[model samples]
Target: MRITPKVSKAKAEPPLILAIDIGTSVVRTMVFDRLGRAIEGLESRRSHKIETRAQGTSEANPDLLLRLVWDCIDQTVAEG
Candidate 1:
């Protein structure tokens, strides 16, 4: 007797667009459907301390900010 492996099909998800914003102190992620409306109850934000300079310049680590943006995107997709 030969046994066959069963393959599960992937479920179709609604079209979504991820809008990301990187600010000096926060990174925000939001998901919208084709209708251009935010999916209810689905959003992500990452807030971190920024480096302040004597000249009133504020900045954040590039690598850290990129990772935070990715994190927010991932969370938004998962929740939406």
Candidate 2:
């Protein structure tokens, strides 16, 4: 006779809220609960650089920044 172990499914979690932060050099996203706590294993971020010149001017690609934010948010949402 042979014996096998059984596997169990994970329990459902409570509802979560989405949070996004855009900064000068990076964008990030995370899921949080009502208590203002970030949920574990549900965060994403992307690094970016600001364009600068010798004249002390700086800027970044608006479209690229938007896409990075969107991608991180989408990934975090799918995690919860």
Candidate 3:
């Protein structure tokens, strides 16, 4: 004969407010509760492949960066 332990699911919490900061080097997303207390967060570094060659150079793949931002936000939301 074998005995098995029962598992219980945790109660879901209220939705949190999300904040994001995107820069040339990295992207970050944070989640806060109604009271402005941080609940969860995520960060992702920009791809090194995207770069500039000459002086006053600034290069970026808008589509790729946008996708990264979305991914970071999604991760933070899921954690919260």
**Best-performing candidate as measured by TM-score:** 2
Order by TM-score, highest first: 2, 1, 3
Q: How does residue 62 of candidate 3 score in lDDT?
A: 81
Per-residue lDDT of model 3, residues 20-46, tens digit only: 777767767765554555543322334
Give TM per candidate. 0.68, 0.76, 0.60
Per-residue CA lDDT of model 1 for 14-62, tens digit only, reads 5766788887778998766655656655679999778999999987788
- Candidate 2, residues 1-80, lDDT tens digits: the string is 54322221132244556788888988999776655556676789999999999999998999999999999988987875
Q: How much does each candidate deviate from the true structure in C-alpha RMSD?
A: 13.5, 10.8, 11.1
Q: How many clashes does each candidate structure show, in the order listed? A: 0, 0, 0
| lDDT head-to-head 2 vs 3, winner | 2
lDDT minimum window of 10 residues, candidate 1: 4-13
Ranking by lDDT: 2, 1, 3
Candidate 1 vs. true structure, TM-score: 0.68
Best by lDDT: 2
